[model samples]
Target chain A: MTPRARREALTGFLLILPWGLGFCAFTAGPMAISLVLSLTKWDILTAPHYVGLANFANLWHDPLFWMALRNTLAYTVLTVPLSLAGSLTLALLLNRRVPAVSVLRALFYLPELMPTVATAIIWTWLLNTHFGLLNYLLSRLGLPQVAWLESTTWALPSLVLMGLWTIGGNRMLIFLAGLQGIPEELHEAAALDGASRGRRLWHVTLPLLSPVIFFNFVLGVIASFQVFTPAYIVTNGGPADSTLVYVLYLYRNGFQYFQMGYAAAMAWVMLLLLLAFTWVQFRLMQRWVYYEGGATPG
Target chain B: MRSKWTSVLVMAALAGTMWTLGGGSPAQAQKVTTIRMVWQGEANELKLYQGLVSKFEQSHPDIRVNLETVVASSDPEYFQKVQVIAASGDYPDVIYGHYSWFPAALAKHFLLDIDPYLAKAGLAKSAYFPTAIQQFSDHGKLYALPRETSSIALYYNADMFKQAGLRTPNEYYAAGQWTWNTFLTVAKKLTRDSNGKSADQPGFNPNAIVQWGTVAPVNMPFGLFPVVYSFGGDVLDPTNTRCRLDRPAAVRGIAFLQDLLLKQHAGILPSQAQQTNLFANGKIGMMASGYWDIVVTGSAIKTFAWDVAPLPKGTIQSTRVATGAYAIPAKAPHPDQAWTLIRFLSQPDNTMELAHLGLIIPALRAAALSPEFLAPGKVPLHRKVFVDALAYGRLDPRTTHWAEMVDTLGSEMDLVWTGQKSPAAATGEACAKIDALLQH
Candidate 1:
């Protein structure tokens, strides 16, 4: 090889080395081991004996596994879009040249900065049926008190509400970046053509913001798929396992039941499902998600 | 500059590799062995344990005890984590485990058979409480050493009983009239609304009552087990290999508890957040708690007068005597040192001193009955009830999967208490699941 080509190749390898090593060690290693583990019947102690898809076969008939999956899918479907909309709405409101808009944005985003445990604790008190502030206010206004986390019907939604509280930061940041990226000339041209505010937003603002919206949607979907901590700490998958998310069940299997092999299988299944969902989202995005410059030819 | 950067990166990578590889080696070779001693206790109790460990280290210069204490809230999770570590063949020499955990640990062969050590130490089997010792033994092999034993009792608000013109629980216990029927009557009398109406009164709104007659933290399996037993129920068959909670008596026991909450409405069902605070604030009159609550809840009960008495009898009188024990792991690197620590902790004098501090009821009968440990000022007033109840206290049926059974039962019982399912239905469901679990 020529000296210049060798030098370029060496520099390229050096630049990529740290990330490449990290990817192999952290991500690839666990993925490969988990796949092997999924086929075994090991607790933490005994030697892992090959069971050959017995764990996956068990999941087919496991009622609790299906229930947990349904609950998780429901939570993700409800939370991701609702949170994205809430974030975008707040972002639009703050994008204007209002007084102290930055301060308002920061104030709105503060809940996301609080530790998850702290947020959960605060929400537990707020959502309590009898003694909670929410019920008290509702009663004062002559509205019926809702059992937020106690009733099986309300428990999952209560957790969804709690999860929504932290969306402000993510939404605000993404929206701000999207809004700044919108070309000023388009808005002025829309105004010159006597376009209404709604028209301008629908045509210019939304199309320009599609890339950021897609990015946030993908991130939100992935994060929402692994919703475990709130249900774990606050509800403990209870009032009859109504809030038992997929990851929470995986945790129970791995730690509580000492069924690590089963949990490993559940994890890989979850990864494949998420991967498929992301792929579908990307495929569907061809119709709506517009690039600023142009769509690349396939 | 390029050479310096490359060298730095290489050195960092090497250092990281070396750090990872070197970690597990030095931990094995440390001559002054650091034994991780873990237990669940209050802050003060932990402080006392630390002091005792320091004393222990002073006496044995060659060994060092690395005290690892966890709060009671995290005790179950910590126990599970430690068990996982034990399974991984890297367990501490000594561990503080609940009596219920002994069967599972022994089943897994994770606990060391300490009978030989006890025999060598000249510790007679008769020295400890018979029930406590029997609970730690499985199939003729003693797998653990009981550090303390506790019994469930009826803890009452003495001031409320007085105001309601009811006799103290001690008087009833003394008269052998502390039956479940009389207990229910007293609960109804003491259960009053803010408008000065008893549960029997015409205008009494159970939901709107400001003060409840009793509070049973229905979550604790040890507290609930006796009620089931008293009603002529058993959690498992004679061999403890099959579940029997679906039986008529067990269903009756569960139904009675649900009636106390839903039908009679004699107690408050606070939201999960309010349960602990409500009990501590004297909003509930009586709660069936363990002897350890004397340390946990007693310190918080300065608002009103509260004392414990023997739990009221059901069809057949019984109560649960739960204990926490010290066990050496089967993989313990220093078995001799672990035994020395267990022997020191289990000595009568040490047990008495510890009990006098109100940590728990000592497992040694002599230490428990000693005046220094049993005196009124040293231990709380309600503790005597636990002492009395020990005569009738029954050990939980030994099962290798007791923890899983408890989790299932506790959750199902919660459903019963919440009026979501009938006692019969919940108990039947739990039995089916438990039977499946046991088979596994």
Candidate 2:
């Protein structure tokens, strides 16, 4: 390579050195240690004896492990598409050039800025069985009041319902950005062809918005799968372990139950599952997700 | 371009040096030793400890305490954070912990033996409550110095009883009529609907009740076990090797609590947001909680007279006993200094000063029995009941799996409380889990 090119390359490498070092030390280092620890029986205080795949073997028989995994899967499946649709609808409504649009956008994004703990606290007050606002409204509608967080049947669903509180949060903001990126010319052309607004949206906006939807769907799935704070702060995985999501159970094993190696195994399983999910999502994307640059003539 | 690159390299070195200097300043050119003490307490308790720590520092000019206050909602959370801290290989010189935490910490050999220090200091074993001392000792060695002892007792609202025209719980106790059946009868009388009907009244509405009878005692050691014990049942057999909660006596206790909540509609689960601290709010007749709640709940009531009473008799009157204590970690950086802090903290005068906070019944016998603790003309005029309970109080069954066992049982108990499972079914399931835990 020429001297100038080599110098430029060296500068680029130097610029990324700090991040590279951090990624290795904090991320890669722990991942390596946790992988090895997963094969042992360490209780944090004692020496870890090699236990082969005993932890994973035990996981096959552990009821709580399966319960947590099922709860998390159900939560993710329920939350992702619902949140995506809700946020996209919100984004569509807010994308118009209305007066005070910036203010409206900021208000919609406010819940995302609030801390998770604060959101959990507010949701608890909203979901209280006898005196909460939701039950009060339900009673007004001549419906029987639901014990939102206290009943096994309703606890997990209540969490899913509360999660809709963030539909106008960051996911909506991303969709708004994606909507703004779509050229106005396409909509105008469709209108010129006498296509109705709904037709234009179906044929033009949706095709262009498919990429953003995929992005948000994947992120929403991952985030929902790792749900912990609300479950921990509110029901505490109860009314018979109905809300025991995977991460909270993993935390219990690692920190509370003195089963660090088992927790590490659980963590690895979660990672592998997430990886597989993302890979499948990427493969499926070719069918629906449209990229302007990738749409080449056959 | 060369000068720009040179300046960038210089800046990188400068940042590196500053980072190193910032983190490396703890140890310096001085003879003074700073021993870290990890503690968990509410704001007032924290203030009390800070005052004591400052006084200790003043007396021992060479020793400085770097106090680390851990904010935890429960003892298990405190232990969890401490365990994580220890696993990181940065051990605190001293740790303030509870009896429930002792078994797990001891199982891991994470605590220092304190018996030798006690002997060297000429501290007599009989100076504290036997149960308090017994809880901290294992395998013929004391691992922690007892700090404060506690037991669950009934706290009743006297104004509610007066308004209901029912005799107060203390009066019932005085008349030897305070058995579980009597307690239930009184509870039914005390519980009121918004329509001014008591729980037992023909037209009373359980759904629209404005006042509850008691805040249910359905927690671990302090709440649930006492009821189980009072019903003449055991959580585990004496050897602590197998679960016995499925036995008839325990089932009877569990069934009694379920019936009160569901069928009788007299009690409400503790920690329900709408029902929380109902005793303090003057919306409940009675509550069963630890001595610590004397201050926690006592300070909140403004409209009613409330007082302590012994837990009503079941087959027998029994309460679970527990203690909080201070110990030096096995790998403490300054064990000698930690011991000095513990010794100063546990001195009779010092312990008595802490007891005045009303959060703890000082483990020091002389201080506990003193009028300061009894607090004559106090809101809870029956302070002596807490002291009396020490006579019959049962320590939680010793086990290395205390946290896991309690959790296993608690989850099942939740189903029973919700009327989803019978007490027999819940206990049977809990035992199935706990029995396996015991084998581990």
Candidate 3:
């Protein structure tokens, strides 16, 4: 390479050095260590002893591990689709040329801005059995009050209901962008062809938005699978471990129980599962996720 | 020439920075050591601690302190924060922690053995409550200087009892009629629906009940285990090598609580137990909590009258005692300074300052028994019950596997609380799990 070319490349490399060093030290470094520790019994306090695949073998029999996995899977399944549809609906409404549309968009996105801890705290009062606003409203509607959090049957679902609070967040914004990106001519053509608005949405708008939906779907599954904070702050995997998500259990093993090896194994398992889920989604994408251009994958 | 001058200037600046960081000068006498002392508390407590630290700094000019606060909702969470900090090789000079993490901390040798320091300070074990010192020790070697001791008691709303024409818990205890049965009866009377039907009365709608009789001791150790002990049950066998919670006595104790929760519907679920100002709102007639709540809940209550009473007699009168203390990390960079800070914090005067907030029963025996702590004309009117409790109070089960055992028990207990599983079955399953943890 020419001296000038080499110099320019060197300068570019120097510019990214800070971030590169940070990624290695903070992220990659710990990850590599955790991978090693996953094969050992390290409690952060004591010296770790290499135990081969013992932690993984233990996880195979750990009832709580399976329970946490089931709970997290249930949460992800419930959250992702509902969130996808909810965000898409909000995006559709926000995509309209209504007056003060920006204000409407901001209002819809406000819940996402609140800190997770604050949201969890607020929801505790909102879901209080007797004095809760939800129960009070239910009573007014001539319905029996539901124990939103106290009962095991309802605790997980209550968390899922909370998960809906984030539907109008970034996912909606992305959907809005996708809605805007849909060619205006298609809608005009559909209308000219005497297709109803609903038909136009289903046939044209939805098809074009499919790729965005797919993107958000993949992201939502990964995000929801790692749900931790609300569960930690609110129920804390309680009312009978109903709200015990994967990460929460992993955290308990690592931090609370001081079984770092077990927690690390759980983390790796989660990473593998998430990768598999995403890969499967990609494998299934050809059937539904439409590409407007001819650059669609096999 | 300019580049060489810049390099020289850089070297001078670096030297100056190093010199300032290295205690100003090498020849300086009475070099100050800034010890990092980690602590956690609420806003008021933190403010008070800041004042106390300032006072300590004024008195010990040679010893500076960098007070670090770790915000945690629970003691175990605090332990995790310190453990993470230590794991990063940035061990704090001191940590003010609770007994909940004692076994784990002691097992890992995370704490410096304060017995030697206490000897150097000429402090005797008899100066503190025996339980306080015992909780901080293992095999007679103390690892922490006790800051405060706490005991659980029954907090009852007096107006509710008076309006119901029933004697208060303290009155019952005075007459020796304060067993679990009478406690349940009183709770039933205190509990009322919007239509004024108490739990015992006909046509009382459990669904629409506005007032709860009690917050169930469904919460761990402090809340429930005391009742277990009072019922002549033990959490662990004498050797601390096996789980005893599945024994008949323990099962009966748990069954009693389950009855209060499910059958009578007099007790709120433990999940619903500590709702924001529930007891303070006059909606809860009785609640089981530690002495710490005197400030936490009492300060919020202006519309109601309340007082402390010893927990109702089960098979025998019992309560849970626990302590919080300031411990030096084993690898502390400034161990001697940390000890000095701990000694300063645990002084009779400083402990009195801490106790005045009504947040703790000072672990210092003299300070705790003083008139200031037992405040005769206080609104609670029964502050001594906490001190009295310490006499019969049992410490929480001592096990290095505290977290795992408690989690196992808590998960099973939750099912019992929700009426999904019988107390007997749940405890049986819990013991099975806890036993596995014990064996390891």
Candidate 4:
């Protein structure tokens, strides 16, 4: 290589060195260690004893693991779509040409800015069984009291409801951005074509919104898979272990049980599951997700 | 470049100087030894400890102590954190931890055997409560020194009993009539709805009852197992190496408690708020709780009278005492200094003062029985019962996996209380899981 080219390459490598080293140290190191630890049996005190795939085999046979998996999947399925719908609806409402739209946007996004622990504490009081506003309103209407976090059946759904409260922050912002990016000429052209409001939305707006919807769906699913804090703080996987999400179980194994190796294995399994789901979503997105420009040449 | 090199040299020299000066001079170090002491407590409790450490420092000018406090939501989390610290080989010189924590700490060789130290310190094993000392021993080796002990007792609202035309629990106890059946009868009578109907009334609604006769905090297995033992079931065998939940006595005990919530509807399921509030409000006639509640509950009750009474007898006539001890870590950097701190903390005078603080029952039987400890006070009403109950109190079964056992069993117990599962079936499931855990 020429001297100038070599100098430029060296400078480029130096510039990228910090981030590359950080990725290896902070991310890749733990990930590799977790993969190895997953196949072993070790409580924090003792040295890890390699048991090959016994931990995975044990997980497969464990009823609680299956229950956690089912509960997590159910939570994700319920949360992602509902949060998407809520976010998109808010975004559409705030996309108007009304005065103080920015202020209204900020108001809707305020909850997202709150720390999760603080938000959880607020929601706990709000959803409390006897003295909560929800129950008080229900009682005023002559409805029976519902135990929000106390009942086995209602606990997971209550968390979903709590999670839905923060949906406006991310989803609304994404949808708002998507709304702005939609050119005014398309809607004007549709109007000139004598298209009705419904037809214009169906033909133009929704097609353009699909990309944002796809983005939120993937992000929401990944976030939902690792749901832990609500269950940890509020229900504690109880009234009857009804809300024992996968990440909560992993936390219990690692921190509470001191079974770091087993927890590592569970983490890798969760990663594999997420990877598979993402891949499946990519395959399925071909049929539904619409791009503003036609599909790029492969 | 010369100036930069000069700056680097100056910085290095300054760092070295600071290290030496801050580290301590060799002559001063011989006189002043820094000891790291670890414990878990509330902010107020930690403040008291800081005050005590300051006092100790002033009195013993040769020693400097650093206090490390962990505020854990529960005992299990506290034990887990300590274990991790121990495993990392960075254990503090002196640790204030639970008696249940000692077995695992011993198993991992993470604690010093303090028997020789106790002997050298002229401390008698007979001076401390036998059960408390027993809790810290493994195969005749002393691994920890008892700092404080707590036992479960039935705290009752005296006003609730009088309003219901029921005899107080102490009266029942004096008459030798405070059996589980009699306790249940009193609870049923005391439990009333806003409509002034007792739970025993024909039209009483379990879900609609406003005032409950008792509060059952299921999270405390130490409190729960007294009833289990009374029904002739034990948490484990004598060796503490096997699961005993499937025993018929244990099943019956659990069922009896479950029946109070489901069938009799006489007990309120205690929440975090209701735990301290319900008993103080005169709404709950009785509740099984530790001595820690004495101060909290006693201070809150103003309108009505309240007092502590011995727990009603089960088949075994037992209660459970939860104790904590001072332990020197095996990996302690300064073993001699750690031993000194442990001995200092466990001195009968020091322990008695701690007990007088009303936070815990003294582990020293002699101190616990002192006139000062038994003196009438806001706490003494409940403290007396705990002191008496200690004679019959059994220690919580210790296992390496006690935390997980509680998690699994506590969840299953919730199911039994909620009427989703029969006690027999729940116990069976818990037994199988606990057995599997034991094997592991």
Candidate 5:
């Protein structure tokens, strides 16, 4: 390489040095240490003993581990599709050229801005069986009251509802962008071919929106698998461990029980699951994802 | 020349920063032994502790205390922070820990033996209540000094009893009719549906309860232990190496509570926050709560009248006693100064002051039984119940596997609470789990 080009390259590297160092120090360093620790029997108070894959072996027999995984998968399965649909619907609604559209968007996005702790605290009162506003409203409408937070059957669904409420802020914006990016010519042609409004939406709009859906679907799955704060704050994995999601169980093992090695093993298992899911989605993308230009999938 | 000058200036600045960072303030010439103390609690309790710390510092001029607070939501979270501190080797010289925490701390070797200091200070085994000292010790080694002692009692709302035309718990206690049977009867009488039908009356709806008879102690140690003891049951065997929760007595105790919460529908299984404020809010007629609630109930109950009575007798009369203790970490730098502070805090005078402030039942024997704590107040008209409870109080089961055992059993107890599993099946599983954990 020429000296001038090398000098320019060196300047660019220097400008990015702080970020690169931070990525290595905080992210890579801890991850590497965690990988090593996952193979040991460490309880924090004493020196860690190299126990090979004993920690992972223990996970096979741990009932709570299976419960946590089941809870996490249930939450992800329920919330991801619901959130995507809710956000997409809101995005389509807010994308209209109506007066105060920006204000309406802002108002819909407000729930996402509230802190997780505050949300959990507010929901406790809102979901209280007898005294909550929710039951009061149901009573006014001549409907039977439901115990949203207390019953084992309703706790997970209640949290999923809360998760759905907060999706409009980020996911809806992406869907809105995807909606706007769809070529108007395709819709015009479909209409000219005597297609109905529903037909045009089905054939043109939805096909174009598939790429955005796939992207948001992958992101939502990963985020939903790591649900912790609401469970930690509100239900505390109870009524009967019904809401003990994967990350909350991992947290209990590491921090509460002082089983850092066991927690690390749980983390690695979760990482493997996420990787497998992503790879499967990538392969599946070929079947449904459509591109804007010649035979390329967005 | 300019480049060389800049390099020299930068080096000088870096050296100056290092020097300042590594050294103490220049004006503090005298060596002061700073005792690092850590505690977890609500803000008001921490402030009360801060006042005590300031007084201790004034009395002992050569030592300064650095206070650190961990605001945690629950006991497990608080212990997690303590374990993290110890693991990271940044543990405070002094720590405030619950009695139940000693077993885990002892197993980890994170606690210091304070018996030597106790002996030197002429505080013998008889200095504090024997049970308080017992709870703070493991294998005959005192690891901590009891900050205060507490026991659970029956706190009843007088207006509710009057409105229901039922005899008060205190009246029953005086009349020698305060057994589990009568307790259940009164509880049913006090429990009313929205349409004013009592739990006993036909057509009563449990789902639409307007007033609950009592607050059920779902799975708390303080809530469950006393009843278990009253039924002649023990949580652990004498060796503390196995679970006795599957025993008949314990099963009966658990069954009674489960029936109250689920079948009889006379008691409300509320959350911790709700239970704390229930009796004070006049939504519940009685509560099985610790002595610490005196202050909270006193301050919050403006429209209601409340008083305490001895817990109803089951097969026997027993209550659960709990205490928080001040302890030193095994590797504390200033053990001597930490001991001095602990001793000062546990002194009769200091203990009495804390009692007068309605913070605790002083652990010191003389102070605990004194008029300050036992004196009747307008709110809790029967303050003697808590003091009398100590006679039959049993400390929580202490073992190296306390946290794990409690957690496992608590999860199973939740099953019973939610009516998914019977008490026999759930407690059986809990006992098996505890046995396995203890064996490990």
Candidate 6:
């Protein structure tokens, strides 16, 4: 290589050196160690004992593992599409020219900015069966009270409902950005062809918004699978392990139960599952997701 | 490029110098040993601990105590932090943790065997309550020494009994008539609906209770185990290797609670917040909890007149006991100093101070029964009931996998609490789960 080219390359490498070093040291190094640790029998307080495939094998018989996985999948399946739809609906509404629209946007986004610990505590009271504001309102409307966090059947669904409160914030902002990026000419052309406003939205707007929905869908599903703080703080993964999401169970095994190796194995399995789901979503995305730049060959 | 490399080398050298300077000087490394202690407590309790540390440090001029408290939001978080600290191998010289925690910590060999220190200090197992010592020991090896011990007792709202024209629990105890049958009858009478109709009255609405008769042992095994034991059953078999929750006595005990909460409506099933301060809420006629509740109830109940009494006899009177103890890790840097601090903190005077503050019942028999501890202050008038209950108090079962077992049982028990399953079915399922876990 020429001297000038070598000098430029060396300078570029030096600039990124700190980030590269940090990634290798903190993230990659620990991930590699966790991979090795999953193959052993290690409580945090004791020396790790080599026990090939034992921790992974134990997961098959562990009823709690299966229960947690089922709860996590239920959460993901319920949350992702609903959150996407809710956020997109909010974004479409906000995308209109309205009085104090900026203020309204910030107001809607406020729940996401609040700390999760505080949010969970607030929801705990608001969901209380006898005394909570929600049930009080229902009673005022002449409806029967429903046990929320207290009932095993309702606990997971209650958490899903709690999660919807924040969808008007971050995901809606993304949807808003996606909506704004859609060309007005397409909608105008549809209208000129005598299409109804609803038809124009169905044909032009939704197609353009599909990519953003897909992105949010993938992220929402991933986030839902790792639900921890609400279950940890509010229900403690109970009324009967009904809200025992995957990450919370992993935490119980690793920290509360002191079975770090088993927790590592659970973590690895979660990562693989997430990867598999994301891959399937991406494959399906080819059929549904649309791009404006004509990037996809017909 | 050359200047940048030169500057990097200079920065590295300066960092090295700073690190070297940060190390203690050779002259500073003498016989004054610093013992690091990790503890968990609320503000007032920690202040008391800090004060005790200062006094201990004053007495032993050469020993310095350094406290590192982890303000645990919950038990699981506290255990997680302790395990992480233990894993780092930079263990504190001493740790103040729950009795339930020691079994799991001991199983993983995180805690040091305090037997040698106990021998050196000329202390015997008799120094503490038998249950306290037993709870902290595993396989005949002691890992910790009790700082305080607590046992459950019946606490009743005095005005509720008086207004209902019913005999008080302590009065019944004095008359030697405080059996479960009499207790239940009294409970039924005291329980009133919104229309002031007693539980036995026709058309009494269980759904709209104005006053609950009692608060059943709803959450902890500490609360439930005593009733089961009173009926001559236990959570685990005698070997502690298999669950005995499905035993007839346990089923009977649990079924009694289910009937109270779900059928008889003598007790209301409380929410999580209600459970914390249920006795003080004035809606319940009676509740059973640990001796530690005296402090909380004393402070919270301003309008109500309350007192404690022995838990009414079931098949036989029984209660579950628990303790908080100071343990040293296996690789602690200053074990001797840690032991000295543990010994000093557990002295009679210190224990009396703690008891006076309504923090604990001293584990030491003499201290527990001292005038300062027994004297009536702001709290329950019948504090002696706590000491009396100890005669029938049994320690919670401690297996190597205590946390896992408790969690499994707790989940199944929740089914019973929610009325989705019978006590027999829930306990049977719990036994199966626990049996599988123990075998694992």
Worst 10 residues of 6 chain A by lDDT: A289-298
Please compute the TM-score of chain B alone for each predicted structure, in the order given. Answer: 0.87, 0.91, 0.92, 0.90, 0.89, 0.91
Candidate 2: C-alpha RMSD after superposition: 3.9
Please identify which of the two predictions, 3 or 4, would achieve the higher DockQ against the true structure.
Answer: 3
By DockQ, the best candidate is 3
Kindly provide the TM-score of model 5 when superposed on the true structure, using C-alpha atoms: 0.92
On a 0 to 100 scale, what is the lDDT of residue A94 in model 1?
A: 87
lDDT of 5 at A285: 88
- Output the lDDT of residue B4, model 2: 100
Model 6, B68-168: lDDT tens per residue?
A: 98978866578778878878878899998887777778776778898998898888889788888888887888989988889999889999999999999
Top candidate, metric TM-score: 3
Scored against the true structure, residue B307 in model 6 reaches a CA lDDT of 91
The superposed Cα distance between candidate 1 and the true structure at residue A198, in angstroms, equals 2.5
C-alpha TM-score for every candidate: 0.90, 0.94, 0.95, 0.91, 0.92, 0.92
Model 6: CA > 4 A from native: A1-15, A296-298, B1-30, B138-141, B272-278
Stretches > 4 Å off in candidate 5: A1-8, A137-144, A294-298, B1-29, B272-277
Q: Enumerate the candidates' DockQ scores in order.
A: 0.35, 0.58, 0.73, 0.59, 0.51, 0.62
lDDT of each: 0.81, 0.89, 0.89, 0.82, 0.85, 0.85
Off by over 4 Å in 1: A1-23, A296-298, B1-46, B68-72, B192-196, B270-276
**Which residue pairs clash in candidate 2?**
none
Order the candidates by DockQ, highest first — what do you get?
3, 6, 4, 2, 5, 1
Q: What is candidate 6's CAPRI-style docking category based on DockQ?
A: medium
Models ranked on TM-score: 3, 2, 5, 6, 4, 1
Model with the higher TM-score, candidate 2 or 5: 2
lDDT at residue A14 of model 2 (Cα atoms): 100
Interface RMSD, candidates in the order listed = 2.7, 1.8, 1.3, 2.7, 2.7, 2.4
Backbone clash tally (model 4): 1
lDDT per residue for candidate 5 within A1-298, as digits (tens), equals 9999999999999999999999999999989989999999888888898999999999999999999999999999999999998999899889889999999999999988999899888888887777788889998999988867767899898889778768778999899999999988998999999999899888899888988999999999999999999898888787678888999889978876768999999999999999999999989888888766647543
Over 4 Å off, model 2: A295-298, B1-31, B273-276
Which is the winner by DockQ between candidate 5 and candidate 6? 6
